[model samples]
Target: MQKSPLTSTGEALLRGQLQTLKTSERQRLRHVLEEARAHGDLKENAEYHAAKEEQGLLEAKISYIESQLQSCTVIDTSKLNTDKAVFGAIVTLENIETEDKSTYQFVGEAETDMEQNKISYRSPVAQACIGQEVGDTVSVDTPSGQIEYEIMDIRYS
Candidate 1:
């Protein structure tokens, strides 16, 4: 399978989640299963059935997380080039039409969080900004229409 990219921070977050799932989550689910088993006969036990379904789903999620962690490659941000809009570079963009400006950090797919102003390198904005320098203008096609942005700055930190 092709390896997916992950920022160091994203890798750490996933690892933490996996650890929690394997330890505390598993222990808690085991207790829940035991409680449901004590309720009575397994033939018509709704609580037991529901708990089993939930436990299966939880185990599936844990397995998925484990696979994802194995298939991801963590990237080190500090060693990357900051001269242009690339992975790990924080780019400030100005809307050519409205003059509205926003800054976004280009990160791996797993690290994309809108609330944190961190976008994936594969995203349209990052795709447009890639290999671009300050003062350069890039146009991106959106559902509404095409939008233009001027590269204002690029920083590593």
Candidate 2:
């Protein structure tokens, strides 16, 4: 199986999620199931059916997270070189056409949060920026059109 890259923070987040699912969520669901079972007939009890469905979904999520954790390779950003744009690097860019500036942190797919300016390394923008140094310009094709950005700074934290 191909190993998926994950940031140390991302790995911790996944582990926390797994722990929550196994402990608090599982306990809550068991209580819900027990309450549903007390409502009598299993065939016609909507509450019981709903609880069972929720339990199944939770279990599936737990299993999926476990699988992801097992196959993940955690990358320590602090130990990496920041001379060029790379995974876990915080890169600042300036739009060549509009002169607008933006900052983004390249992370694993599982840790991507656009609202937080965290992008997946596999994303088009990150792909274009990877291996590029400061002052380098990269053009990426977007849904609207091709946009060019010049790298201003690269930092690893």
Q: lDDT per prediction? A: 0.88, 0.94
For model 1, the local distance difference test gives 0.88
**Candidate 1: regions farther than 4 A off:** none
Best model per TM-score: 2
| Candidate 2 similarity to native, TM-score | 0.95
Residue-level lDDT tens digits of model 1 in 50-156 = 88898898899899988888898888777786677777888999999999999999887766899999998888999999999999999988999999999999988
State residue 20's C-alpha deviation in candidate 2, in Å.
0.7
Model 1 alpha-carbon miss at residue 117, Å: 2.7
For model 1 the local lDDT of residue 38 reads 93
TM-score of each: 0.89, 0.95
| Model 2 clashing residue pairs (backbone) | none
Give residue 50's error in model 1 in angstroms.
2.0
Candidate 1 similarity to native, TM-score: 0.89
